[model samples]
Target: MEQNLSLEQIQNFKGKYPRQLWYLFFSEMWERFCFYGMRGMLVVFMVGQLGMNDRIANLQYGATQAWVYAFTFIGGLFADKILGLRKSLFWGGILMIIGSVILSIDPKNFFFIGIGFTIVGTGFFKPNISSMVGQLYQDGDPRRDAGFSFFYMGVNLGALIGGYICIAVAEGSMWQSLVPEHLRWNVGFGFAAIVMIISLLTFTQTQKKLGTIGISPLLEIESSKRKRMETLTYVGSLLIIPVIIVMVANTVYTDYFMMFIGPASILYLLYEMKNFSAAENKKLFAALIFIIFSIFFWAFFEQSGGSLSLFAVNNLNNTILGVKLSPNGVNNSANSFFVIGFAALVGLVWLWMAKRKIEPNTVIKFGLAFLFLAAGFWIFYYTKFFAGADGRTSLGLFTFGWFIITFGELCLSPIGMSAMTKLSPLKTQAVIMGMWFLASAYGQYFAGLLGANIAEASEHATNLEKLNVYADGYKQLGIYALIAGVILILISPLVKKLMQEVK
Candidate 1:
């Protein structure tokens, strides 16, 4: 399966990869700018401005994050059949822009509405864009992994810039002269909306370079039928937005929603298994196993946005060498900074190992991811020993912990994205990609459960008590991650065999 490129097309780029990759790269970068910008401040805003208890805020954050990914399955279904990737991305961007504007209005009731819109919009946009990236390369292209790595770097680049900028805006540090302190968070949300518009424009202008890759729907329909379907989609989306807003505001309902959808989704995948050839079935099963493991990895890893953000604010020292930093925002950027710094190096290492025929398989790479995640948590757990009289630990330690987890992310996230495209049957590619994110949804839900404990424990009067609670939680998480990593490594060979020659 060669790329859809003629000799002239091949010669035009004069680069190792297609020219479209750059366009996708920039498009994704701006989309991520909108996403991570708000994400960097979400929990903080909920706790500080909205005056929510930490437990409620954590639950809401977790539910919001979960729905954001969970809804991707629906988005992927629409793209795989009715909407096509291009239209999905376009509409998703429009919805997100609107959501960001709504979020800027007020953090009370409007927050849930804003989150609801963004969740659905991200569902439509995120997975389809990634699937388009996969379509740019041929099956078994060695550059495929490297291409995704480069794409992942763009994601992190957006995170790095947006994280800092949003924090500055929210804190009124950047535009203090123009914006009042009370309205700074609104300014940050507005910034996100503005960047999302840029992302939509970039994709709209440059998507033609994709050469029909994501331009048409997978299932052809009559023009009249297509219009009807599009109308239904719009109506359905509008109706569901309020439902999601309700779920996010209610933890029990959110839990029930996840419980119902999680197993139902797996059963749906199982029911579709009969559609594939034997070999494809085996590969899909392997992908499913990896996806399940990914849920575990993400459950712990995703604490960065919830408990970890709170940890930075309430527990870590924000002063570094006499410079006061915004701990939550700066800490959020740490993982992205590490990714930007090391992604290319890691890609080179993987390529070098491949040349020597010693590259680890995808399953083993996933195992390594769990191991790194375990180590990262253990590092933070150990920081309990260094807690000062103020009950705060060194900011450097938390940053270093994030640095280690970035390595774990490099091993899992982009590699998982590549694996989904490689392993799924061609007919169901986008849905499978959505399943990958669905794993993250489960992880996010689990993160909320775990973070709620931290929030509950943080209610203790003494800093020592808070540190003890966090330490206890991390100690258990580290142990569980270590065991999971080891079990995955032990079974890697079997999973690899199931892959049936997919590396």
Candidate 2:
């Protein structure tokens, strides 16, 4: 009886979750492993292998990550109009595997080449999977939140594993006897490719149970044109590889590219507004506010991949509570590890408050996220005080700062995803999700700039000089986050009005 169920019937299932959710969960988990693993390695490899200066490495990291995210908007649009979710995801996975393979074969030489494929690939894979998960539940289903939360845990689980191991291998902390120092990077990147293959296979094998959930929207179109459209998407994505590589290698081009895309995206969204009613438009505007704020949030938070990763390499001690560990791995994985530990407990705290009629609304929750972010960055800056004469600091305190930052993430990110879906009209869900990710693109771009400036500020070769400069930069970010949080809280009423009954 269940085998023949349509998308609607699947959504109507009488369980805490439809069985397909676990498949999607595992698929996304492996994809995230590929992604965060690459992220944790990028700047480190640039400095350690390619012989790039700190400033250049930061900018390149920013540009590479920015493009990776910016393409999600394009990927989302292509999925909505032509390929649909399933095809987009499969194609994206293939591209990512290709990218990782390229790097594994020769990471130092083909770094930008590999990253270009990854940028395009991630766009197609990231947003659509989340949308498919949403499709598994009918609107207003009480289980929807739990299902999404379950999926969120999958994301972190992959990040935790990949974050730890991939960089560990790259840094020669794992299988030190097997992986030579020079080839460690090759194996590290290879791990991403290997897991992405797993992610794709998981999706292919399990997606049967999803029924018509993610089918291409063009079945009604004539066959020839549909084939042509699919061909064009693949070719176009491939052709853009060199362009992305150029932009990433030369940071100035990234600025030009973003200047074009950022405003163009706003205009396009405004054009999209014609289809939505006034109230729906207001809710979208509110969602936009959140997206805009999120850019700032991510800019600071993403230091983990750029500046903090470098910080971990240079400044921190090599142990957490007496067990020897890789500081870079800790830097990369600590937040993800904390998210795994605390995500459910934090959700329960919010639920408990809601049941008592005292829960913070989404807007306030967003504000609290910034406040927590501010506190976390402040703690990061305070690490300078804990540093030894050699400028090395306590790994335990550094990881503790991530604990507070995790709270901020718990407050905003999941809630923001929920709000984006709830507030947008049915027709625009994928586009809005794309926009949410695009905002992350902007954040990543700026984070690179921020990290570069900090890197540039320290001319001396001393570890102490680098520590003070980076710590001071973090202090400034903390102050900015503090102001943003306070302002968001102050203006909550207006955003609440825009949200209407969304909470």
Candidate 3:
């Protein structure tokens, strides 16, 4: 029999980590498998099967991902106010399963419709789980960063497996004997749905360990009124599905939506700030600085899913160490692989540095992340110098670049998740985490525009021409990322001052 674990008891855990993190870790792992599976398939499917141009596919990928993260704000709000973390996650998982199943039915025809479901579902699913992870540790727990690091591993582990398998399945690299070439797209999508069900079930069986941590925020409300509020939220969520379909299908609508959401979120945050102390507000502002800079960070780093995917298709040889492999699969899964390998070691490095009292603060870590990001992009640019006559570059160098960026990602992303929880007021933690992802939404939006501009090689352009064009863009991005790192380091004192004792 299961019991309701109190928040106090969960947070009272003073060990290296609480056992609950494992359950959340596994549940989140499966959820990410579903997510990355779909993500790995998206732009590739659009280009190869849907007959879309690189620019259009990039724009569509951006819109789709932007909507996915943007809705996290809405989902976080709902979970904070009504459904609570667990329910929001459960509802979101159901929607994602539905979306993947829909895509499996007829990938090209139902692509946008399926994506619409996924965007809204991910909105509901993404932020709340991170918030719950935050709840496991008491404020000022030294282990919080490592806990998040372990959780981050779950995310990448899923990405590594699904990222490869889903793309391989869709492209007939796997299941070739069973799934016909044309129908592989369907199986690829269907595979995501099957795993999503497992994700939801994993949470269902283990969520009791979370106890009251993710329970409804309306526990104090009258029962009937709570029911009414919950009902309205469910109905409202259903209604947004079609609207999302429309927005995701048209890049122009995506532009409009992004323009509106950013200001609206800021205004809402301003409104919410009235409820907190001056000190908390300062911390919030500090989190805002990180959030603001993160948009640019992602703009450069997120090329993996957008332009880089297409680049892999057009410009890279397909093999690793003379073993036959897919460049696209390598592009899709490489960062996740590196992160999985490095996340824990990186986390432990922080612990060791802290013990020696030589730890770089979060802001410095972020700055260093950008420096590595710059180096990775520069390497990406340099790869073109070694291209063959057919214009394919060294797969070894491309993968090595991802290895460098993985350090950047390790420095920033898991740390950013930790920073949001630390900086935010307890009541608004979900909102802040949502804001963090919303920054990624903007990053994805601009990543699309940047990728589209870089993919200017004409249909008749030679492979070498295409490689040169993309490499030039990457060189520019490298310079920008390097500049961003320097500026962040210069400004770190101010942000660190605001963060005060949080780090």
Candidate 4:
């Protein structure tokens, strides 16, 4: 039987007030404001401003995103063990703000610097804040999932707003007259930087209130040996990065980042062995399994920003509500649109299930996520029916596909985060979370590889042939995803058993 938490525990779990959550909400909102805004524009900038092929641009874009998530694991570790959550959050936010400013300069050097800073900032900010959300609820608190669901909604809300707003500012009609084509990229990044500052300020104001509720997880640790090993791992990874860059110079492959992932994985494995226990090891192994599957999920889903974005620009009819829409505006907004509309509903569904003792286990949901995503891609694949006379596709078909993809994301992303927190023991949470992002990094790399194949093939193929390639790939991916989902479902009962009441 489940033990009901005491009233004191309930009050304690509220963590200062609902307002504190709101403060974090807005802070995250702005951070995502920068992230999604930049993301919406990144591929477009790569292809248009830099004059790279779609294949090269998508590959680079995927690498950047992979690094963003991969580094978050490292950042999460720093916050967990060294910097403490608040300081880490502050430093990360500040660095991100600075990165945003530099990116607004729109220099080629600034691109590298922006990626670096954004990576550092995400490292410091992402997991710590996510951890804080869990801290808001006491052990065995029933409301923990509900609270995370609420918080996850904030994430989608931010993504939704940032997606549309950034596209509007970046792709506006006024830009033709008010700004030069080359310099216009700065406008979106500048806005993102300003919003990031506001987010930082919001967090600063709420620190005292939040401080009373939960202490930093790093406070009680006294293991210098663990610290030393972590330092060594990071330094080693840093030293090897140049070698990887050199290799990238020589390789014919588009994904230069995979070389980095190889070395980074080695460093991480060595680090995990230091002072780690058997249970933690099991959890890490399981987490790695989930991470592996997530790569396929994200690779396909992320095409929305790259291949899909370009597809929308080139192929989709963008007339909506009797107003001519920018292709960027339509394409970039799809995930955000579904996220904003359905996030709350998905949360409510989970809450209702939890109430009835029927919430699907995380692994099972992961399977469902894969199938749903595959189904969405299948929708696009079959929608050859909607391809227009001018070789365009219906905006409606793409919209429906995005909705299905978002449903898949809803099943995976938040639930995955929650699993990362709950399944792992206290000591390795950040590194494990980093591993989660690493999977995404790999997925992004794969997405880039796939996009490159599409782009390269397009050079030889007619438009109809190109569309057929996309359709065929989509169909294959759909079948692959269906198999993954079915396998996960078959394994679900056992995976749930492995979780051992972690739900």
Predicted model with the maximum TM-score = 3
Q: Give the residue spans of candidate 4 off by over 4 A.
A: 1-11, 14-19, 107-109, 173-182, 212-281, 460-464
State the lDDT of candidate 1 residue by residue for 1-503, as single tens digits.
Answer: 13455434533444446778889889999999999998888888889888988888888889889999998988988888788889988989999999999988885568888988999999999999999888877777777787788899999999898987897679765667888988898889988999999999999998766766776573466888888897888789879998888888787898898989878878888888888889999999999998999999989988888888887777888776778777887777889999999987888788888889899999889989989998999888987888888879887887788899899999999999999999998668899999999999999999988998887977855877787688778878989999998999999889999998899
In candidate 4, the residue pairs with backbone N, CA or C atoms under 3 Å apart (3 or more residues apart, or in different chains) clash, namely 66-441, 73-434, 75-123
| Tens digits of lDDT, candidate 3, 20-103 | 999989888888998988888888988889899888899888888888888998999899889999899999999999999999
Off by over 4 Å in 1: 1-16, 172-178
Winning candidate number (lDDT): 3
Q: Residue 80, candidate 3: how far off, in angstroms?
A: 0.8
lDDT to native, each model: 0.86, 0.89, 0.90, 0.71
Give candidate 2's whole-model lDDT: 0.89
- TM-score, cand. 4 vs. native: 0.86
Q: Candidates sorted by TM-score, descending order? A: 3, 2, 1, 4
Q: Which parts of model 2 have CA positions greater than 4 angstroms off?
A: 1-3
| Root mean square deviation (Cα) for candidate 3 | 1.1
User: For residues 1-503, could you state the per-residue lDDT of candidate 2 as single tens digits?
Assistant: 55567988888777566888899999999999999999999999999888988988999999999999999989988998899899999999999999999999999789889999999999999889988887887765545555666678789999999998999999998889998887899999999999999999999987778898878889999999999999999999999999889888888999999999878887888999998899989999999999999999999999999999999999999987799999999999999898888876776676667668787888899999999999999999999998987989999999999999998988888778777778787667778888889999999999999999998997565998789999999999999999999999999999999999777
Q: What is the C-alpha RMSD of each candidate to the true structure, in Å?
A: 2.4, 1.5, 1.1, 4.9
Order the candidates by lDDT, highest first: 3, 2, 1, 4
